[model samples]
Target: MEYVSVPTDIPDEQTPLLEVYDQIGPKSTFTQTTVNSLNLLMGMGLLSLPFAFYKLGWVLGLSLLVFFCMLACYTAYLIGKCMEFETGVGKLSSFYDIAYMAYGAPGKYFMVVLFSLELLAAAVAMLILFADSLISLVPVLTPFKPQIMIGSILLLTPLTWQKSMSKISWVSFVGVLSLIVLTVAILWDGITSPVGPGSIFDPQQTNMWPEDINQIGLGIGLLFVGLDGDQILNLGHAVFPSLYLDMIEKKRFGKSVSITYTIVAMFYSLIGACGYLMFGNEIQPEVSQNLPLVPSFNVLLNQSALSFIAINPLTKYALIVHPVNSTIEGLFNIYSDTLTILSRTFLSFLVLLIAIIFPSFYKVMGFIGAALSFMTVVIMPTACYIRLSWDSVSWWSRFAHSCIIVFGFGFMTFGTYGVMTV
Candidate 1:
């Protein structure tokens, strides 16, 4: 496997998560895990909150965001719990390891496929966001959208070649700062806009619920996508195992999940509500673009915010593709760095091709969150926990897990079908 092997001479203070797996003691503390979890939760997922609210309206949108946040936290807790399960080899060390222990090799392989699909969907979403943002920033380059996305493939392909967490660890900070800048800029613009405070409690163009009752499924799906950490099996799921293992008190990871996800839910609510209020029915899928959509009196201000938002996806692109590259390498046994880089380059072009084919930011992300991520985050963790701890789990616990799985399926099915038809 092409693990992000750290250099022996690297500074202890700058050591990345993957470096200390076998270290004497846990290198990460509870506070550190919570912060890392928050960083992981707050990525590109925020970009689509307004678009989701526009589809489902305020009532369902906010409600679903809260609901999914709790669900994600719970499923994430299950992941940490599954980590304690003995696999004959030792405790689980990774998310897929949970599958391998619970359901054996078949389960492990299924996880690999699902995890890959989740990454593929996420990579495509990033490209769409990248392409869409580029178009918004420079419309004259509009006709060159395809070429721009292709160019992104070339530019970002090299970042994927760096096979160490220390190299990409700094990206978490960039992602957090950029997202904060974009969110603050939007909020500031919205409050100062002529729209007034009324947009807060009640917006003119936004809805409390879907305009048509039949479209509820689509709205729910978009909400699911919005929770995709995205920038995770949308970032939360992808990084959970690493953070969990690195924790000083592993059992307490659930509390970290709760705190991190709630904060993220608040962030999503703030941005989603603010964006929908400002744009109302006219909102675009990427919320940052919506900031300048208004007869923005602040061209320089809005453009700077967009400039900040633009850097985030690129910073996250390689990290997002890292797992996908690693997965393909493991399957094909491509151990050499040369073959690894070649395979990653091929994967980048493949991602670009997929992005071109399914270009709607809203549709693609919604499908991924509902269909692919629903499996990785909601379904798999719950199932693995039940299987791994079936004998000890209470009947009520089983009932709750079953209920979550069943309830989520309704929306997952509806969301996937809705995006597919579009």
Candidate 2:
């Protein structure tokens, strides 16, 4: 979608550090770009919650939040580098081309491989999850399970198959809202429930190490690694236009990226901490799958008329939220069993489908590990942007940052290899 040119009344100092492109290409119908990217990423980050709880318990979950913070800081820095080098056109190859513009052919090729591979893996993984959800919903449809999986590839192809980032942004927004409602309900039950224990940190417990650090390490690796692919790439896709706005322009790209990172990281950390605390070590495999088992909604959705309302939290929340923004907190107390069955059915289908395709849990871990590690930890910041920004920073500071990024890449590579071998 073509971006409308910013009004020219702004001061000379207000223009972006980088030259602003009047149009961000063909305009899209998607309105909620920021919201979509935020929720999808939070979903991926929270996907690790159950495993984190199982392996390390709540304490380690909190510790992992610290790691997420570090990762977010790094992400923001890379994004600023991306923005600083942005050439106004927000195409899929924007970052790769920007790196090329600043550095050369080597830099461009590296980014393309890194980003494209990572995004492909991410899109496939999400589609896998989507198919898995469907199969669990209708067992008799089992014969067509493979068809359903392939069907999703076809279904998503149009939605995301089109090159329009704006439309993708909107779809992402709907997906994100569905996720947010589920998250809110889960957290509400968590906090107000009888078992509520407010503090996330307890200083008295000293033995921070778990009995099996390998599983713990692997779980930790998966938590951050799954976050790459679609969500971050989408961020690169949508955020560039907004970053060119006056407020963001004067602050420099770093502050905007920093704010975005901190907000998103804190959100995931809170939800992960809350979910683990509420569910204890028995955290669900993925948040969406566990929605069916959520007790409050289960009881409320028992009736027939309200049954259809529970198909998936995505639809449920949107229908209610669309007409009246205030309806969410108003009617959350009402539950319908049909809604329960529907959500659970969806959850069951997804789990079974994923199990079939990725028969071994290790495959999920391995694929996610390699793809995310390459994109987030190794390729984008370290290899591509770093090459472009090599002279962008002072020599000593640049060298130190490069060393740290390299260390992160090495650890991620080691973890990916470990997942494959194990």
Candidate 3:
């Protein structure tokens, strides 16, 4: 259960920016850190929010989005506290570090297992998105989505071999550009053509409230999946500690994080509202699928947007699976080219199979948010905070943390069931 630290052969110039910043003393200003967080994590869940709005309707959907954002923000603060608890063994680097500090080896195992699952789930969701985009772009690429998913995996495998994080940093730009183009295209169409076959602005096309109150549980899960795009700031529990530790002033994490979450929530709410108004009950899981791909400016935007989606995940497959690969290599005390290739191949194929099976971006994301994220974002933070700061943590804070844990379980349970059933 001991966390491994496997050194790579990447040259000094290729070291990760965060590591370099840590070595040189954190120079990241609050604005810079917040912007970095926004750039890296904002869009993972953004595309799905419109359909999330469809599920819970406008009111409840937006409420859950904001609420989940708040939860992610506060838990992030909890993570900072966990790091502050101090094990007298220098700085803690990841969720595994915090877990091991609070509860020993068992905790480290839990973190590794859960984090690995979450990463694969995230990668799977991305694969589904990338494949779906290909099908959307080229209707004749063997209309079967599974085939596209496999083809995309095989094509991206070579790029995934690059061990240096710098080689893939450009992936961030792909995500941000794609988000801007998609958002602009969606909002532009929503404003310019508010009434037409592809345009919608009627009560029948949208609702302030969901027709079934019972869906509120399922709605929470779905919206959490989408809102998680920002609230976790896409760092996930595994990577967040490093970002937090790299801050110029760790004390300022709350402020920078709060501002980042607010920006993400507002943008998500706006796009969710606009997409619903445009496509109403017909919005696809990715939202881009509903864009008016007519012969116009929008079509050009669609091409750019789809191209980005297709390429974005291809870049991430290696990054997400790297941690898992490292953990296994470090745990076994063996590292070689053969091991790296086999591990990456096994992980990629595993996720590809999962994507081919579930296939629905919405459902897969919902399960991730409901099951994995609820645990990492909600349960783990509070648990770690209480364990690490039980004495110094305020009495009210302790009670609040406990209450949030119970609530998280309900959300995870019901939310997961809802995804499976709905």
TM-score of 2: 0.64
Q: lDDT tens string, model 2, 1-422?
A: 23455655643644553344433333332223333334434534355554554555556756765665566556545655555554434322355455576567876666555544444344444444544455444446646756765554333322222222443344344445445565655555554445323222311122244546666545555566534423423434223434333222323545544555566667766666665555554455554444444444433322211122123322222221121211221334323545433443343344336545564333464456544654554445555556666766788867776776776676566657655554
| TM-score on alpha carbons, each prediction | 0.87, 0.64, 0.87
| Global lDDT of each candidate | 0.76, 0.46, 0.73
Per-candidate clashes, comma-separated: 4, 21, 1
Candidate 1 TM-score, C-alpha based: 0.87
lDDT (Cα) of model 3: 0.73
Q: Residue 112 in model 2: shift from native, Å? A: 2.1
Q: Write down the lDDT that model 1 would get.
A: 0.76
Q: Compared with the true structure, what per-residue lDDT tens digits does model 1 show for residues 1-422?
A: 11334445644544443334645453678898898787666666767778888888788888888988898888988888887776544567787778888899999999888878877778888777887887878878878878988888889999889777577767656666777778777767766666532244446566776887655665666777655565332445756998888787777898988988888888788888887887788778777766555664467777877776677678778877888888889889999989988999998989899889888888777777778778777887888888888899899988898887887787688778777775
Error of 1 at 45 (Å): 1.3
Name the better of 1 and 2 by lDDT.
1
Give, for candidate 3, the lowest lDDT window spanning 10 residues.
Answer: 1-10
Question: Which model, 2 or 3, shows the larger TM-score?
Answer: 3
